[model samples]
Target: MAEIIGVIEQLWRYPVKSTGGERLDSVEVDERGLAGDRLYAVRDSAGKLGSGKNTRRFRRMDGLLRLSSRLGHRLDGPELFDPLGRPVADPTAFLRAYLQRPDVALAREDAVSHFDQLPVSVLTTATLDWVRGAAPAAVVDVRRFRPNILLRTPPGTPPFVEDGWFGREGGGGARLAFVRASERCAMTTVAQPGLPHAPEILKAIIQAHEGRLDALAEVVTPGRLSVGDELSLN
Candidate 1:
């Protein structure tokens, strides 16, 4: 029997990197990803992708981003706010705020522009447990992974092994489609504050879970999602 789970969860579109993400009760999905997901990004002084990928060059970005959003009418054009909860700026003041920190440096601020690895990342609680059981030393947390959707499935259900291919109905009757599995990198090794010390959690997941613990999906087709939308396999 195919079981259908109600609306799982909703994550807000966090445009900035490193700071914090906003949670939402409902949201609209789009092709690029959630309406506001990765809408903005940071660059090194020399205009390089300022993300965890090249931590040595932009390690300051590790804990410097802040993102938030509010209710809006259209999913295609929903407005995004800075970490301060202010409207998006013309040149984007958020980057300046991030660069002011001493830990951050500039090779050429205008020369780099790095987007997040994925527009919106999603993971499941079951997946976390699976990794934990396989690698006792691994301590997986949603924040460390920085996923946008954290669906809670049945206890016996498997982890989010194939999130890239799953789809569900939104409360507003929109359909969310899974696009592809997420490819991991070295950044996963970095520690998130307050989480247990499992420096190799990312490596552990790659070793045990067929080298994948999370997947990246997009709203290939626009849809509305609520807190309790039914989850369906594609």
Candidate 2:
């Protein structure tokens, strides 16, 4: 049985790992995920990958959260976006200053783009709302969590509904097989652009859902996904 629950709220891609990401009206989903998602990252001289999760390596990836990455249909045509949605020309040097490491270099994920778990991650407005209720003091920005797909659940849907989608087929344009609940990491607590540092964010997730906030999936049959599209769970 297939169920239609909601519309796609937003499609997000983080060109550079741990940095900011841009929203898309539509995107082509491939085996590696959205064409340009997490395809590039900032690497250090020691070959350590830069990520909000790998704080020991960069020490300030949270600041990178203030910077966002964007790209056109072509992979080579990548750009960085500021908080105000303005394009930035020199993301390397700009990110280096925030990280305070002159040796850090931008490299594609081919070497190390910083993927934590599965290729695709999804979250729902219901879960976000529940977390907000759990942690009113901390800012509950979805950017802090960095999910690849965001779905706006139907009205009155219960929180943590993503867990129910496991083992089900999902997506409108792109067909995906839900795998498991994505485990939360320290990265969620880091400060992202427009969001301040709030360690309690992770605490809310742990207390509410045992440290899992979203569902992870893999492409079953590659296709495209777009905002306002309807995803079905079967």
Return the top candidate by lDDT: 2
lDDT tens readout by residue for model 2, 150-210: 8998889999898888878877898998889888877788766667788888887888788
Question: Once model 2 is optimally superposed onto the true structure by TM-score, how far is the C-alpha of residue 216 displaced, in angstroms?
Answer: 0.7
Candidate 2 residues lying further than 4 Å off, grouped into runs, are 55-62, 81-87, 111-113
lDDT of each: 0.54, 0.80
C-alpha RMSD by candidate, in order: 6.0, 2.4
lDDT of 1 at 231: 64
- Winning model by TM-score: 2
Clashing pairs in 2: 20-68, 109-113
User: Model 1, which residues run further than 4 Å from truth?
Assistant: 1-6, 10-12, 55-62, 65-118, 135-139, 163-172
TM-score versus the correct structure, for each prediction? 0.67, 0.89
lDDT of 1 by residue, 106-139 (tens): 2222333333444556577678677667667666
